[model samples]
Target: MNLALKDIRHGLFRFVLTCFGLGLLMTVVLAMIGIYNGLVADALAIVKAPAADVWVVEAGTQGPFAEASSIPPDTRDAVARMPGVAAAGAITYQTLEASHAGRTLRVYAIGYELGRPGGPEQIAEGRGIATSHFELVADRKTGLLVGDTLRLGRDRYSVVGLVEDATNTGGDPAVYVTLADALSIQTKLDPAAARVQAARGAEPVKRPTVAAVIARMEPGADVGLLVATVRQWKHLGALTEAEQEELLLVSVVDKARRQIGLFLGILLTVSAVVIALIIYTMTMEKLKQIATLKLIGAPDRTIIGLIVQQALILGGSGWAIGLALILTVKDNFPRRVELEPFNAIVLAGIVFAVCLASSGLGVRAAMKVDPATALGG
Candidate 1:
């Protein structure tokens, strides 16, 4: 007795085909949203991984990630002695193209104090770097497994451990090694280059200098006071963890987020137009039936119900299909795709509202069908 159900059943194949196509489009939209969320989450993971209270870098620069930052390797000792500091460690970072098994891999090398504040917090497999020299902990994404040896700069390193989700905002997998090894890798000078510097009466750059020192404040410690104290050193800059996260999230990923948002808006607009046109065409095909119902005493409410129900069915089915597809293939995506439950619920609400609003065009056309038209047909 329901006009919407009867009409859909009458052209079930066409309706299913149309819904399938719309579902594909919806899947893309959902995936895009997930990808954007994943990007932001990944960008913040490096900052979160350290679990530090404050980061001290070279003055006037955002440490290690956003800009060039270098500080004396011994800065950790000074920062740790400050009143509110609980622990401190020097950390260094550099990007390198490493070769293993005849294939090249790009990696972000992190130098940290072993068993200290700046080292890898979790290892998925193998053991943490047991030997300081030439031992490395690599993210599994780098495709380097335990016992695999790779050449970095002028030295060779053996993969000693594996870490998961340990990548920088730039999506480069992080390779962890000792602070000394990182400094040597980052500032690689050939013997010739070193000899030239010595011959010119310039001291060869020292072997071990770190980029930054990370510190954890004691419980109830005042970050403002600690920052003020560190500033007096004149060679170091300090940032609270929250400020570092904000710098990476807002300053590093801002353009990518905006670009994704613009794409989402365009996709939503296209979806609305497609839904509206589909409903309008379906309504046009049923004009004679609508007129007949009008002549037979069907109320305006019944006509409105038919259009709204059809729209709901279309949108609801599409949403379900899209969600399923996103879940199934999300893991295979190159970059992470994080589809949270709340995000799904919100997108569903938006799609439903859009469908309902779009059905207005169909409702208007249906309401104008003259009762006399049924007699002519």
Candidate 2:
């Protein structure tokens, strides 16, 4: 009773090959979606990890992520001493490549004060940083084990703990170091550069600097008051948690997000065009059979059903194959590719809608088949 199933069975091998090819395309489209989500997750990981009520940065600038903003290291102490501030910590972030096991690993170096708000909220393995220097809590995605020793500029560090899904906006794995260690790395110049600076009568690098200050408020503290206090400092600016997240998601990565959206759009358009072309070709290949069916008095709806059923089968098959492929290889990517079930479901539904839409070309062609052509044959 199902003409589509009969036709597919008649060319089972070709049909399956077609499905496989289409599956690969679907995988690419789905991967793009997953990648965009992963980018957001990575960019926000640091923003959310601190769980701070307010962020204080250089006045008139968005902190670390959007733009460079540095404050005096002692600002942490000053902010902590503020009226509404229960606790404050100075943190710094930068990207660096470190040698590990004969490979260079790109990592986001974070300097957090001990007993501070900037430590990761969750540890997936071992323990968090406890020592004042040369200890690290690294993201597991860095391919680091708990006991692995990593060498950063002028120092060797031991990985004490591992966190999951922690990365900078650029998708580099995050590594935590003590404020002192980070300060040394930041200020220590090449020996030659330091010698030249000294000869040039350059002032020695003063106290260490921090990228931003994270603060948590006392119970029922007025955030407006804290913001007002921070604003008055003349050298500091503050953003609430909501404002920080918005700034990162909207203002920071907006361009990259739009580019990814455009890429996804192009991919969808290509998919639609390919599906339409394949269906149109399949209908053309079966023109003689279609003409015979028309001569036998089959209705237009039956022919339409045939095209729709075939499209659904192709779409479903490709979706299944693509999902399996993506899941299998997602971990192999350098950056995180988070393929959530909900996202997959939504994509599958959209794919089906596209498949139906693409079948229109074939349906129209099939409907125009002439019975007289079959009689001539």
- Number of the top-ranking candidate, with TM-score as the measure: 2
Per-candidate TM equals 0.93, 0.96
lDDT of 1: 0.88
What lDDT is reached at residue 77 by model 1?
87
lDDT tens digits, residue span 2-28, model 2: 999999999999999999999999999
For candidate 1, the per-residue lDDT at 110 reads 88
User: Which lDDT value does model 1 have at 373?
Assistant: 88
lDDT of each: 0.88, 0.89
Kindly report which residue stretches of model 1 are placed more than 4 angstroms away from their true locations once superposed. 191-208
**Candidate 1, residue 207: lDDT:** 56
Clashes of each: 0, 0
